[model samples]
Target: MNIWVTSWVAADDGVRLWTATTGAPGASWPVVLVHGGPGLWDYLGPVAQLLDGNRVVHRFDQRGCGRSDPSDDQRVARAVADLECLRRHFGHERWAVIGHSFGATLALAYAWTHPERVASLVPLGSTGLGDWRTPARAEHARRASAQQRARLAELSGRERRSAEEEREFRTLAWFTDHADRERAWAWAAQDAAAPHAINWTANRRLAREVDSWPEETVRARCRRITAPATVVHGAGDPRPAATAAALAAALPHGRFVPIPDAGHHPWREQPSVLRALLLRAIRRA
Candidate 1:
């Protein structure tokens, strides 16, 4: 069975970040899971458990998110620096980095800035480089039913939402993130109810920074990264896997993997496949 231990790590700016470590008691290979949502708290707990206690897994709430102390600094650079601080606090010279969605983008940025400090990078369901949201939005609309779409629009048009209304809105908003239409609502609802409310302020700030990255400069940086990166995305995700494939191609040592019949969160739909791929990647790294 996997054992979990929680602790606190201070970022360079002195924000107290909540962190946890788990897995086989003496597991060797160290891996850190970075959750998506520039503003969301750590939601990779399931992924860590899916690792099957084979390696030490680390997870943390980013600054101003979840259990971490709130801070005014929401810069992308600061987030990367906070990750480095977490690594140093754990005494890992190099470690495997696994990130999902926006977290994937952040992981890429981290690897680009600190190539030598990263052993391997696994980006799961990332938005990828360039403009991916347009296609993604269209896909999401197509996947959502008319009633779901109407309800979502109604909730979004609200000037202010009560707690229940907000949850409903979020659930509907995320309903298209799964390929399994029957299960998508449940999965999205679970996500909406997860601890640590979405930090919209931090999301806006960090998203702006992410959007500012010039494509050419980003590709040039990718070419210089030493660690291997595996860009894995769901075949049914709203975000086009082709964009992720292009991202992989731009990297010096990057490969792309597309999971069948899965959407944004592949683990929820294809746990075994994801687990096998992750185990192999971590062991090889």
Candidate 2:
């Protein structure tokens, strides 16, 4: 693994976000790696490794997660603001953003609000423009085993869960097969263990906000993004590929790339292919 420097940056609301950077600071194109899960810990060191030689890569634990201080403010808007603060902290004129799942949504929100600050947008395994939970729930039901289904049913009405329980639920819900789940676990195990790194309170709060996000508003903002964009989706991902295609189509300068036989976490399932796609996006930017 390559060495990198870690630091803290204060957001507009005085929240200190934990951040790290790798690769050459003077690189022509800087890329920010945004991890999925609004409340998940930052475990994207491997991602940075993939592109470290060619571009500067930045990763951070968003507010209320990982090394950052816990807070009641978990709004998506606040996340966008934090991203902007990160950009300024780096003193970069503009940078490309690569995000997965919910982080992809945050990347878009940032670009939509400040298009000029974004050099490129790469959204992988992204949630669609509208309510994605309905189809996601249906897909989970169809793919889950009887025991898994029962477990999910039992947890459905519950309002609280331990970090361990939430991690288990996410493992079951995010991956389609045992191999994929194991791979995700192994990837995450490399990161420093911190109690309450995945904040359930913030996760639940932000999830509700995402569920009610307006489709028209998202579409309108997407259409305004003129930065070069690449929307990548995995073939085996529960979220329909059409959602990614639609999002790509919506952007003035966007294209879609579907990875075969892969799930939501393409880097875990097919690192070479994911690396190639990421390199391509960086070049385009």
Best by lDDT: 1
Winning candidate number (TM-score)? 1
Error of 2 at 7 (Å): 1.4
Error of 1 at 115 (Å): 0.7
Clashing pairs in 1: none
- For candidate 1, the 10 contiguous residues with the lowest summed lDDT are 20-29
| Models, CA RMSD each | 1.4, 2.9
Sequence-dependent TM-score of model 2: 0.88
Deviating ranges (above 4 Å) for candidate 1: 25-28
> Residue by residue across 59-95, what tens digits does model 2's lDDT show?
9998889898777898988898899999998988999
Q: Work out how many backbone clashes candidate 1 has.
A: 0
